[model samples]
Target: MPNTHRLSPVPSTLAVALALALISPLASADDASGTTPKDLDAVVVTASPLKGNTESVATPVDVLYGEDLDKAKAGTLGETVAKLPGVQTTYFGTGVGRPIIRGQEGPRVQVLSGGIGSMDASTVSADHAVSIEPFLADQIEVLKGPATLLFGSGAIGGAVNVVDGRLAESIPDQPLSGRAEVRGNTVNDERTGMFRLDGVNGNWVLHVDGLVRDTDDYDIPGVAILHDHEEGEEHEEAPQPNGTLPNSSVRTKAGAIGATYLGDRGYFGLAGSTYRSNYGIPAGAHVHGEEDHDHDHNGENDHEEHEEGPVRIDMVQNRLDLKAGVYNPASFLESINLRAAWNDYEHVELEGDEIGTRFTNEGYDARLEAVQKTWNGWRGAFGLQFGSTDFSAVGAEAFVPSTVTDTLGLFVLQQKDFGPWKLELGGRYDQVKLKPDDRASTDFSATNLSAAAIWRLSDGFDLRFGLDRSERAPTNEELFAGGTHVATQSIEIGDAALDTEKGVRAEIGAHWHTDRVDLKLAVYQTKFKDFIYLTDTGVEEEGYPVRLWTQDDATFTGAEAEAKIQLADTAAGAWDLRVYGDYVRAKLDGSGLRTVAFDVPHGDHTHGYEVDIAQGGYLPRIAPMRVGADLGWSLGGWRASLGAVRYSKQGDLAQNEEPSAGYTLVDAHVAYRWDRPASSWEVFLDGSNLTDEEARPHTSLLRDYAPLPGRGVAFGIRAYF
Candidate 1:
């Protein structure tokens, strides 16, 4: 029994009053000192094992910091970085989301913490949330294109690294330094607070950071259900509030502490962190019939009923990290860097206070690298990496079996400067083993090779090209799953005989930058010998549709472009215009292997259906084409921006999938800052969906039941001391 009461909308008068309060004139001073934006050639560490600037890297890289990061911050990593050139979110309600890069997601796109893998189970399913918090990050880096040579086969598509200064690499300039922020949003009465502090005493440095967040169910523009237009006798509609989605609330808290000792040559540090959260899963239950039904004279139920309820997840994680670096070391190595981390995570699914399922994961990752001095115009590093995880699920709704996975990899990278051109080459070898408690074990070996080049055509222009061959081993869920998944309303089946997935990718791009303009354009294509994907069988099991994990040949082609121009500059301020667009198309290569014909049960009745399993079709849940633009202005310590993004209709749908309509969203933000002798303070206001558009993200599996948030505003203040 769950609450079924309709929720009332937030009063318009309250929003107007808040807007007026935020717009009041306030005293502004000169721009903050030593806080200007970085140049285009900023150093990027994630692109290579060795340090390199953006201009020196052959692949495309996007970095967000300072005010830009604050403006893009959202509840999930996917939505926070969705505005980037070639990034999208697999939005599973407001509580869970993961980044989808270049139209590739799941195991293909790896998410990293600092320079190492996060070791979370977010990639295992759509409903699981990413474990990291964006509000505490100092900088986030997006490395586009293949990155398998450095991070292993999981990064065949790309990688996202969230850099938070938890483990101190260097001493702070001052003895004591810190920053704090507090914010609140009207969309769901959300409130968030965060703080970070660092202290230096003699040769020892210490760090501490923490954050807490809470929110109610978010608001929507219309009813939850997106009515189907088919001419039928009737379609049952659930009673929903006009402006709010049910069971969409969330609460989270996390903290970390670290200490480091600095010596003449290098530094060593250790850190420990803990994270806890409880969040409701929106529209996750599938009620085919009521708990009890009336019987007829023949001892059979005459009719069936449906019921809905609240579902939630309670999760916790504890992690420990160690880092060490030595400079000017003896022997063949000029420098050495070592990093290791261990994590213990667990989560339980609950249906109206009753436990439905529990998931647990314990893992550790370690990597060691040694950098060599320049030799014959070549400089690079060689490294060894090891990782292991034990994962298990119990209770009635466990869809995947318990398993242990282990991986070992060795890699080498080399770079040489040749006049106006730079060349880079890398290779890696990995061995992975998967062992299930109740099934046979499997092993896989993968070899990856990558080559890239950058040519400086002119003082303000450069050309880039890259090629890579990568392979990925199947995950445990794809090889041993055989159960009903209530979250997606489907009965899933896995094939243990599936083979490894191999892909070849080629890319070419150009970048131009100057004092007044910046532009980037890239085009890429990828072919897969064996690509693993989930397919619908056009049949029913129990009360749900049946889906199977399968493999086939596939291809993906896409392009992305972004440009910015200086509109005006005067004593008052500087104005700039920005435009960006991206598109990706995916298709299966071969024909069907067989045809499936069966009877699908609707309630208690059966209907016959047939589908060609061998017929080639488009991939499911692919993001549609998107185009957008923004205008920004900055004067002294004040800044303002406005932008709009339009998503095209998604008509190329897979078999048994529904199409999503296109919609546009508008947003705006304003901020003012004041600088003092020892600290700085800033206040800002951000508004989203200003037009109250009924926008639905095509990448979301629950788009028909959960639309995007309605019109709302957030105001906050930050302090640096």
Candidate 2:
């Protein structure tokens, strides 16, 4: 069993904008009956400068919060949102999982916190965890498709924005309010607790929040490793771990405090927070092999066996933010908003008691936006954003060189309404510069444009279409990485001569909503001018495989749909049902030429010769088709939900890539609430993987070594005051 002792390691973190209030964009929560809107029509998309709701915006978006968010909350952001259509997770372990949006991962998908880049190194590698904690977020917003016109060219795939309530925009209606929760899991013997408090006095609002989590090695439905299809190829003396995965423990703690001063027409806020985590990487899967020979007393060479110690990561981050905004300005501008943040991040990779490598990143991101008044049905917002980062790594695994990056971007978004037709247009320009300590400085420019239109056919029916062209400057890692990558156990080489990547995407969608029924459907395709990717070179360096980052033309196509139906209120309670499905296909437009050459010993050492061949165009790690259903019900002080999702077997073939079998996951949740004059109390229980199926996602680098948790139950109690 994992230690249940509670410890506070630091004081840090965010003010939040809690979002749980509906089913989909289609319906709104009924306060009197305590029912939620399960559809997508009414939730506001706060990330947009225009401040438009889901239904009012031309982009496809979804917001999760309220009781729905409560039930969906998990240890990692990717797992928390994986059930959503067109979304998947790249799992390194229980401690590391990054969201993969619409067949895109790594730098292509941007993860934001409170409208700003997280400033963490999650994008640098798969083993690095995202800095944002889902337990502290009041609401989460997911945007699908190219979001470059508003955010940046890096967000060509899409973006996930977490609203941490670290700063208060206005004085709360109530004098004081807060919530607290404590939950535990069985599969990993996990324990977690969190709390958030908000208080208002005069024109000032104050906020504070914190969380702690600890878990041991997680149990698996079966053996951790699958047997090899081709037998007798390897030594069978080593035994495989069964029932539980080793070196998979985790411990985390985080905290933050913030306050905002309110004026008659403006507000200013300052906040600070910190986060720390120590997580173990699963053993056996990622191996570092070295041969050692000892000279015997008689001068004979004796070979000895070597074993590697368990690996773990210790990470810490501290951040400070400033926000100032004024509404109803005297000029043509209706509002002015300014946001800025500075952070220092560092993480150390430990091999047993010794430090193997350490990474450090210090950076700041700042932005300013001006909103224009509505004139002749025209509304818009102009934005200016600036950012800089200094990153470096020390020790044996410093695959990427030290570099400093700076960026400046200017963007504009405009919307016009005419009768039942709404048209939206946006454009952005950015200049990015990167200077490496050992390489010459390089600069690149990016241009992005998007156009969309919505036709309101009826009171609750609409059609939406969008088209975009986005360009991206290469990142430092993609251009200069060289040496060993510990996470994937490979020698990664980067090409500095790579050019800017360009993508053109087009999508069409339809939405229908009635008094009790809501539906949404959409499809999209993207063509890349120079799609950059990493591929194995069929070469070896220091006992590790070699992978090279290169570029090629490619195509990606995908579709997604979701529906929610509100049944009539019954004697038991009000019920709602939601069903969703999504699929994506990604392939290189054509094959690429590859070469293999290595020296071999034929009695005497024989010189190697180069052999060139064509490689397959298949893309690796694309998510499989998925379908799921969720049922929700609520009465006065009680709420309940049950859900299941099916992942189809992925047979898509990429050169040297293994196929992943699919599995079904079943989960259920139930909670009861009772209110008092000064506080409210609730107790809840959640069951996951009740069927105990051994499930592994193709997107996981450790898929063969780590399956998801087996049958497990989590129960908790929460208090709101």
Candidate 3:
């Protein structure tokens, strides 16, 4: 590992490390074996049809399972993995958070459930929450770069695949096995409970799982809204909510049931699941005037008897899925896998006790994959995927018009090995069509090609390289939106003449491992011909600023590194140290025509009138540089770890973006386990924000109003049989 020590007056890597360590406790220790939880690198990368582990695949991947997964689990999927290198999460109060990969978010990053789309409206807006529950996942895989060749063109940023194992592929070894857990948190008076049961009956396998989580408004180190420190300017006194964030509570319930038929040559399975949540939007984050409350009631137009109050979203989703596989059905074929899912989702925003707006969606996704037998040292897979969605909104906040979208895709993957080296190549094509209400129907086509190579330098080291050319078609909201959105308090305008985004990326990685040490590093760069983004126009309509969806040439460059060393082993036990750091630089390219420039924000102002210029410009909400380290020790049934990370102050501002301050977070945890012949029990204590620092994420749209939870501790117990 490189040295990061520095003086107090200087900006140093250690500063970054210290800040990261302070944010939250990462999941890295394991009790399964004497070895650390880093062993997940050897697990299969299910997102890929190649069925290769992270160490064998050319693509950069991260996997967390077993004991590591138990410790990392959080209320939202994004929060569960925010500590990973090169990954961050977007926060919108206590309930909403979506994963951001290399500064790419929204539709650019895909969230998948068992190799398929999560089939939710999360990508439609920042205020929406992801439907997939992290507490139920069996394993979570993160593809850290362009995954267009394996997933879809929209995955130019990357993909997060949660493998819940709802539909089993094989029978269990024991007659019955399962796990249960219950936990409580101090910051929010949280109570959460979850359980899973898997059983075998003759030639059939059964599975059932469920979870419930509830929390009150959480505590904060200071006032909920920090106007004084904003832009580093002093502000006059104003009424501000203190200590606890108002209207920031959350409640959720989710469950699933599945069964599989075991056969000699093939297997088939089905699953059904439901997710429901009611969460509040922070006080200052959402503001609607009395005029906006008049709704269509009892065949009347704009009823006006409603009273003003806080805003909350009630969401629910019902889904069904099918999976089937055939092994050696053909003489020259290896296997065939088929999967499909259908979802019905709806959400309503409430004003006081009255309904203000409602959104609904119906969607289905299906895929068929076939693996071919190896011929002359070459092997590959072919796949066909199709999906459709009908989405609509009603009432005051219906900014985007209702629309129907359909997609069809075809892809192929091939690879061959020669001695100590492996070469892989892939290609994909997709066709997308959109039909908007009272608008012309539009169609788009996208193609992607990729190549990768892995060379085993020695028994303990490996090097890999990858290159790809990808394209992404615009979504309906990006092409036709034309009204105000209450959640974001912005007037959005879309462009119908927008073109497909094209990008070329190159990445290189290296890994070295030994019994007592492991180290990995990767560097990547991508150039986009037409990068689409929402820019503040500096124009206002009824107190809300107008944001336009536009595109321009852009560039993204980043690097990530992680290391682990077994520092010592004595009569007391073994001690280990882990450290990681990452950063990404995103900016509009100077090669393109000059883009708009604004006078920019100061003291709560968004921007001034827009202007034009020809120069480099920073992208907004990109996570600042981070570096962190953790030390762990174990003796008998007791295990413990403590760590902190430093997040640098993000001064790279978009024309209208706000500047965020720097801060560090500290966290620690301790767990004890006891084993029996047929059962095991474990109890843990998790602590976060030990310093109670006032920190706001740069990636949050409500950073000026909502802060992270204050210092708190959580206690939990788990049982497995």
- Listed in order, each prediction's TM-score against the native is 0.90, 0.90, 0.90
What lDDT does the true structure give each of the candidates? 0.80, 0.82, 0.83
The TM-score that candidate 3 achieves is 0.90
Q: What's model 2's TM-score? A: 0.90
In model 3, the runs with Cα more than 4 Å from the true position are 1-41, 228-238, 289-307, 591-615
Whichever of 1 and 2 has more lDDT, that candidate is 2
Model 1 steric clash total: 2
Candidate 1 lDDT, 209-273, residue by residue in tens: 99999999999998776742235635354465568988889999988998988888987989998
Could you arrange the candidates by lDDT from highest to lowest?
A: 3, 2, 1
RMSD of each: 9.0, 8.7, 6.6
Candidate 2 Cα outliers beyond 4 Å, as residue runs = 1-41, 227-231, 291-306, 592-616
lDDT of 3 by residue, 455-550 (tens): 997666689998999999998889888777767778777778889999999998887665566777777889998888887766755556778788
